[model samples]
Target: MTEPVPAASAPSGGCPAHADVLPLYGPRFLRNPSELYREMRQEHGPVVPVLLEGDVPAWFVIGYREVHHVLSHPEVFARDCRRWNQWDDIPPDWPLRPFVGYQPSTLFAEGDEHRRRAGAISNGLFAVDQFDLRLRSERIADDLIDAFAGRGEAELMAEYAHPLPLLALAGIFGMPEEETPGLLRDMMTTVNGDEGALDAYQGICATMERLVAHRREQPGPDFVTRMLNDPANLTEEELIADLVLVMTAAQQPMAYWIGNTIRLMLTDDRFSLNLAGGRRSVGHALNEVLWEDTPTQNYLGRWAARPVLLGGQQIDAGDLLVLGLAAANGDPRVRPASDTPALGNQAMMSFSYGEHRCTYPAPELAEVICQAAVEVLLDRLPDLLLAVDPEDLEWSPSVWMRGLVGLPVGFTPV
Candidate 1:
């Protein structure tokens, strides 16, 4: 377990100008948080607490070393309700207040309860070699590309990244293919938006209820059914919640990872040429791409468990702390050679680390992106380049899932 690292320069807390907010999520930067983050890292320096959503307080910790400290001490820096900022919108009777009643996913859970659940679920990915589902992953990757190959070109993220991981979850749950579209739609609406997220969440909750109900009568060796069958592991509600957590685990990041990596390579002719050949260094390019830009802007919040001096500033037990994975990944202290082109994996901060680490198969995810998506794009579309000039493409205005809104490429139909 990595311990929280003190900010070498320390944090300067409290509200940044409201004017700065627009640029942070403005029409231009939302499409690419990295550009905003890079600019902010230069302007804001390191740690700064900006009151957001009209006075919901949060400390946006930007330094890589500082982010490590906060996540490593998750026992001290809790991920539960204490960190939530539910400013003016709380009805005393609301069943699931964003701050208090929410249990987002197992990744953010704290204490014995977190261990009770996380320990059980971690088995599927990291435990006793009980499930080596590698071949299944390769099969899915090949099939996805095979479906799109005849088109001569496709939007790799939508055609592949977005649906594939969700299908991996479906495959894990033994769900049928017909459910994939709805499941994909369900996840996209639920996770990406800040507005209407609560309503979108209700749809996901209802979908989970039905999925759970469907599985009870037709139990199997899938992740959900396995958890359902194990009385020691999951209660009914917990099983449903856990499925929501697991399904969302690597969904968007992997999608953005696929898109971002391809974008990075193709835009930079040097990397593009390396990728076109499908060398061993494709692994390196994947590493470099992840380090170059991560998908999510703000990390899921972690709270101060008790009073502590962070960055030499006093933080109360319940104060909210946000580790800017987007910022930290690019922080030169952690990555002095971040801008330098290299294939070495010095641990990209994209999926995050520590107790609240990513639940999906990222290495496999990277392999799939390279093996199927990136290679196919290069080999198939030799003449198929970005539809517009690289500078002309537009990006989604999302703080969390940064990707091109549309990548219209003019290609010869080979």
Candidate 2:
């Protein structure tokens, strides 16, 4: 990683003189931020400063030009939040940062340790020569869609959304169906991380321990089995860590966004009409969903390795940094090149930018789910519509991840 850009010097005045701005403080700015962001962008132009960081003082970066510059410059910016994300490292005064319990999945890990595990998993999980793995995912998607199609007016979240990816995950890891219930509990624990949640993380660690031992003893064709069969590829610990990150990261947002895609279409007539056409148009619809409706809301939470000056702003060392992805994606300046008023474009930071981008990009993940989820549902029940109004749905109170608490949709009997 590059050394941080030197912090700009200033006189007795609180902030640097290069820019005229006040530190932003508002609940709406932190919580339901879209409205506040729009106002800030309009008034502040390309520089909108705000307070953030779970346990440290920092600036929330919320401008098109500034955010792009900061994200592109990773040396100064590192995704090393060991100070806040880890259990013991958290300061005694503050509550544990939500979702810190299960994050830092080798995805959030940095340096050689990160590269070794991420590379190992990337190779093992996505070795293109393994055509059988791709076929397995497709088959799993098909079976899942078929099951949901049979039920008219299914609650997409409970019936189809959450279950499909969990099934796919089971196939990839070679875990038994009987064990998935315990696994899901562990997965949800990651979402509501606490001391108890951290304890559940240990339960996950134990599950992985048992599974790895089993894989070592009885190697098979599944991902873990394949890696264990040829131990030369990665160290045993690296393999275990990657498995944990891959399984947990893969399941959480995949299921939520798959369900949310259908939710967006149900909420808006334009999105619905776009999906009514041929399969190729699915890409456009998916892009629209990613830009307009995000599952994992912000770029990964990051901490400064040292004091740095970025995008013409000075950030002190150890300060927190939040890249407000949803705001950037909606910023009118970087909107997609479409004749119609585009809801969003893929360049949007929804999947994030920089070294810590989501392992599964939104467009690709959505394409797979849409092809599998939509094909079955659309054919079986052509008139499916949302049971709840878009405005009425409750989203995660979470400022970091903009996901629906529940998305209720209904379909006529086939």
Candidate 3:
């Protein structure tokens, strides 16, 4: 491991004037974040200042060791957004409100509350039979491919990667087929922070409430029922909040992982040749993408609970910090100088770490779903090829997630 980088000193009374507060949104950063990260690391070390959607100042931890330290010491760094010092200053119409704003779920909880909520989520998800989940995912993949297999060319992001995870999650939650489409639309709208986001969010809440009521009346073998029966005894509001977390987490990251992995397999010549020539498996491709281009590039926002020195930087109480997962994964200290694959290496912080580390079955399920989706598509469309030049591809503008805007491809029509 590389020695952790020391933080630069700030003035006695406030944040250092020289701190580089990079804009996380907008076209420039979205286009080539890796380049910007490289520059930031070289010039500013790991803990750089950054502006969120509303020009909100926060620390962006980019070094692998530094991020690991920050995540490990949750005692000093807290998850509760109520600890944020400038929370009152942020306006209501911030574009990233839906994501960075406060929620009642475990994502924003700490200590005992985190444990309780996380336990409920784990119990709920654990009740899901992995085998059944795989089958469901495979079936969804086949059905989705069938829709575009005849077209000979299609945009995979919207037509396939984007919907498969949502459909699978709906199945796991036992949502009715009639209601799944509307639910997905509402969730998407909320995530994009577009027009009617508030209305769409309300729609989601209403739909979830209906689902909970129906499950209570007619219990079934599903995630909601499992949570309802868990010893955690989550309140009705807590149940709804946790369910929303699970659905959002499952859908967005899985979609991005599938899309990013597929993009790598289709565009990177070495990856494509290795997989085709039997030197690499879909798992290898997936792992490489996780390391180099993780779907959730930034996450795990923490507020400094009290005055502390982290990686030599002085952080006052209520200071906000976000882990740069993608940047940390590529941190030179932990990664090799060469581009060779590090087989069996699972040290990446994409899923994060410490007390809030993502419980198993969720991450495993995502991997299985993504791998299954890719295999089914490749098997069905053997000659799948990028419809546009790789350079022309674009990524969505997001501070927390990194995903392609679209993935257009051409293949032989079946």
Index of the highest-lDDT prediction: 3
Local accuracy of candidate 3 as per-residue lDDT tens digits, 36-56: 777778867888866665567
Q: Using Cα atoms with residue i matched to residue i, what is each candidate's TM-score against the true structure?
A: 0.82, 0.78, 0.92
TM-score of structure candidate 1 = 0.82
lDDT of 1 by residue, 206-252 (tens): 77778778888888666666677653557777777777776665566
Could you tell me which 10 consecutive residues in candidate 3 have the lowest summed lDDT?
A: 2-11
Number of clashing residue pairs in every model?
8, 0, 0
True-vs-predicted CA distance for residue 194, candidate 1, Å? 6.0
lDDT of 3 at 309: 76
After superposition, candidate 3 runs with Cα above 4 Å error? 1-20, 195-198, 274-280
TM-score of 3: 0.92
How close to the true structure is residue 14 of candidate 3, measured as C-alpha lDDT?
35
Score each candidate by Cα lDDT: 0.62, 0.59, 0.80
Tell me which residue pairs clash in candidate 1.
4-69, 5-69, 30-397, 30-398, 31-396, 31-397, 284-343, 387-409
